[model samples]
Target: MLKKILFALIMSVFFIGIVSGCSESSDKEEGKGSGKQTVKIGYFPNLTHSATIIALEKGFFEEEFGKDVTIETKTVANGGLFMEAMATKAIDVGTTGPGPLLNFYVKNKEYHLISGAVNGGAVLVSAGSSKISDLKDLDGKKVAIPVIGSTQDVMLRKALKDVGLKPTTNGGSVELFASAPADTAALFVQKQVDAAATQEPWGYVLENQAKGKLLLNWDEFAWGKDSPNTVVAASQNFLDKKGFSASYLKAHKKAVDFIQNNPEESQELVIKHLKELTGKELSKEEVAAAFSRLEVTTNVNEEVIQEMADISKEAGYIPSADIKGLIDLSTLEEVSK
Candidate 1:
């Protein structure tokens, strides 16, 4: 009787050990699925990307993503690098220009414009000494763009087209310089470029720091307020994560609301964030000035984006502008609803 009792105890102990081991293994597998992971986001350090800035600074992403996920951010000087990072899977979701996103989407359908960020925060400025009083003056002068084929570049091309001028790349007289916006100011000070197509507060910076003159205001620029300057983009794999899109868009919408509802505070926040990112302390003047030209909203106009794509194709940036599946706002619609 003692031996039988001892054998029963041993069997029970072994079964419990197996069950405990299985539970632990299952837990580890679950962890691999969603327990802990790092999410990488990318954006340019421009006012046009303020939604991303505010989202990060205000901790909206943290609140939505929770404690289990880590948020990693990468800031690029130009849209070309931003899209390049997306292509290499360096970033999961963040903000970028509609033009760069569309141009890249045409070549590689690996990403989608999840939502609209900010619209019409860009302008065309001529150096104070360049004697470029109007668009036609750009015909024989050098123009700086954030990047070749960027949103600003496309806008510059359009403006040039209106004036019967074109970038040398397009077989016209205007000389195009592909420079980072931050560096474009130095180009102006050095007389390296006569004009620049850029977004604020860089436009404000050019006006103040480099004595740049605004040749075309935001509304006067291509598509004006209808132009999709900054937009939310996401890699396909990241969008595939369960509930990730909803969480991200929730944070994005929250940030946009903050920017809209709290105007003065939002301006200061942008100034502080810009200083932190660029090491340049911007005044309320430029921040407010940039804010004036910008419309922060979650509404993305597909018709405007389609127009941008058409302009891109006309400029030979892409073979065709058929971005049929480039925009998948189903998640955004669901989240908004």
Candidate 2:
């Protein structure tokens, strides 16, 4: 009886050891699979940031991570708020125009232009009763922008000045105000505002449904056809961590591939996702037109980014002295996957 009892105890201990070894191996596999870090991404629902929406729908992030990961989304009421979030490290990555990024950098904050999000989607629209048929006609008009320090605001200021009109002066030639993009479009429709410089899908909505006419689609005014309207940015700290940024860049590359390869399918997905998040579907025409106006490329055009910086500087959004060292694009070169 004593021998049988001892034998049973020995077998139980051996089984437990095997189970322990399997658990450790399983954990290591999971660690290798899931990546050593988590990524929190921030993006807007507007067409300016359609790439992010399409990316999420297509499972690009998941493919890159090779395991379960967490993805977070937040809506920035304006570019100022977005920059504030970046400064505080509330998000690891974000998508927006270069204007805000440059401005933030000038203020001594650091961020990396990790990848490209979308190209052009910006447009200038005038209310039906407004006499603005071109940039030349924008003289002496009140314009609405999503925010004072936003990319649209900077672009509008530059476009106006390009036409020989001063935005802040020249006999009150231009009055620019800040409001949400959708709200600005509604105000344009109500005739409370003469025009608005806005990014896509919003530009599409205003033109098609609100009786606004397009003064300039993206190509005509800002970066011309292939300009990088939105870029993927990351905190410097996030970039310094091992393998985290690589995983993010890999995911971003997949997103670019998915967008370029499957635009039509991506558009459908964007509409569905946008509606779920925003409570409305972008019209088929809007999606089609907006997509046409945008190029989904990961190259952050240095010239265009510099132009955005110059615009912000000249417009008094950022001091001219700070423009030179505003960009920390080194990481851009690092993660150009």
Candidate 3:
């Protein structure tokens, strides 16, 4: 009788262990089945990121991702900060300038450009009273760019070098000051800076409100016309997840379409969101003038991007970069189909 009881107790203990193991396994599988619970998107507040702003304001991302997935949007001031968010996995996807995006991609081959957000909208502006008339006049004058390694910065550096001038940082004649677009506009208005190479609608603000002059519209510059200013990109981790990339691209395409089909309404949306993000409300004329300078589209021109990469490399902003792998338009194409 004693032996029989001992054996039965041992059998019961063994069965309990098996059941516990099975339960743990089932829990893990359930966790995997749940997939990603939240999707974090990062973007700049500039008009170049209008697609991201409009999509977030319109609930297009939420509607596409459904209620199960929480969509969180983070507004970054510059492309460099946006890339930092991506590096830390704080943002699953982002919209940034081609300059910062290419620089990041060269260092960390973990992100890929999924689509283009906006093209053009950048300008080289000088104070109305300034003697600077063109890039040639930029010699020995103080010029402001949004950020040191920004798209505008890279373009300005190359343009100045081509004009036989150089940025102060790069041992040249032009004195470069890296300031926020708004601050640049204010400085230009106050006559604190000689010239500002900045993006629109801040360029518009500087020209109209700040009494600045447009020295060079972006179209006249290399890598300007239909160039990729802002691009939508996703991290490798996000791309590894099922269904998330597709949903994101779908919403992005929709936002681009909305921008094209509803111009006035889209401008209003951009204005409203810009106010919410930057506390700066632009007038209808200002917004319209800004839009006239920018080409908002979803098409990613690989050749233009490659040219940008080459420029960035030549400027020593990045090491050798193979941009072919940096671009993955398959997802965008799939969404279009």
Candidate 4:
């Protein structure tokens, strides 16, 4: 009788353990099957990221993700910060310049470029009294950029080198300062910096509000008309989740299409979103001017991006960049179809 009772208690304990294990396993499977119900998106508030801004403002992301999923958007100051956010998984996807994205990809292989966000909209601006009419004149002057190794910085450095100059950090005559575009605009307004290499609406603001001059339009820069200014990147883990990535890309495509096909409406949306993000009201004319300098699209130019990587390496921004596996346009292509 004692032995039977002991055996019965052992079996009861075993059954409980088995049931608990099954429950835990079921929970994990359910979690995996359900996937992430929320996605964190990171983007800059500048006109260069107009597609993302429009998507957020116009309900494109919500429309794509439906009411079940929650979308959280973060306005990052620069690509470097965006990359950091991605590193900690704080953001699932982000829009950033190819320069910083490439640099990040080289250091950490977890992020992938899924689509293009914007092209052009970057400019070299100088104080009105600086008389820096050309890149050559940038010699012996302090110039500000959004960041040290950003798209604008890489372009400015390469352009300066083409003009037979280099950044002071590179043992050249030109001094490079890194600051936010808004701050750069203020510095330009105060004549604290001789020039600023920046992306738009800030460029427009400097020209119109700060009385600055456009030293070099983006088209005339080293990368010329074909360069990609911003791209949509996602972590491999996020992409591996499946449904959300495709949905995000579809919404991205829609935003680009809306920008191209519905210029007037898109401009209004861009202005409204920009104002909300920056807390500074922008006029229709200013927004239009900013749009004129940019091409809102989803075309990822691989050759141009590769060239940018080369430029970044040559400029000593990155020791070397292996862009292989960095770009995965399969999702974008599938969404387009």
Specify the highest-TM-score model's number. 4
lDDT score of residue 240 within candidate 2? 80
Measured on C-alpha atoms, candidate 4 has an lDDT of: 0.85
Ranking 2 against 4 by lDDT, winner = 4
TM-score against truth, every candidate: 0.87, 0.83, 0.87, 0.88
Q: Which of candidates 3 and 4 is the stronger one according to TM-score?
A: 4
Between which residue pairs do clashes occur in model 3? none
Tens-digit lDDT track of model 2 for 1-337: 9999999999999999999888877776545433544567787777777777776787777776655566666777566677778787777786877777777777665676767778778888898889778777777778888887787877787777777876754344788877787787679767888898888778888887888998888888665665667888777777786677677767777777788898888888888988998798778888999888778877766667777777776677778534554445555466662
lDDT of 1: 0.88
Local error of candidate 1 at residue 120 (angstroms): 1.1
Task: Compose the digit string of candidate 4's lDDT tens values, residues 89-181.
Answer: 889997998888899898888999999888888888889978888788888999998888899988887688787998888788999898888
Model 4 stretches astray by more than 4 angstroms: 1-36
User: What lDDT does the true structure give each of the candidates?
Assistant: 0.88, 0.75, 0.84, 0.85
lDDT tens digits, residue span 253-325, model 1: 9999999999898878877898898898877888889999989988888987887898799889999999999
CA shift of 233, model 2, Å: 0.8
Candidate 2 deviant stretches above 4 angstroms:
1-36, 169-172, 321-337
How many residue pairs clash (N, CA or C atoms closer than 3 angstroms) in each of the candidate models, in the order given? 0, 1, 0, 0
Q: Where does candidate 4 clash, by residue pair?
A: none
**How many residue pairs in model 4 have overlapping backbones?**
0
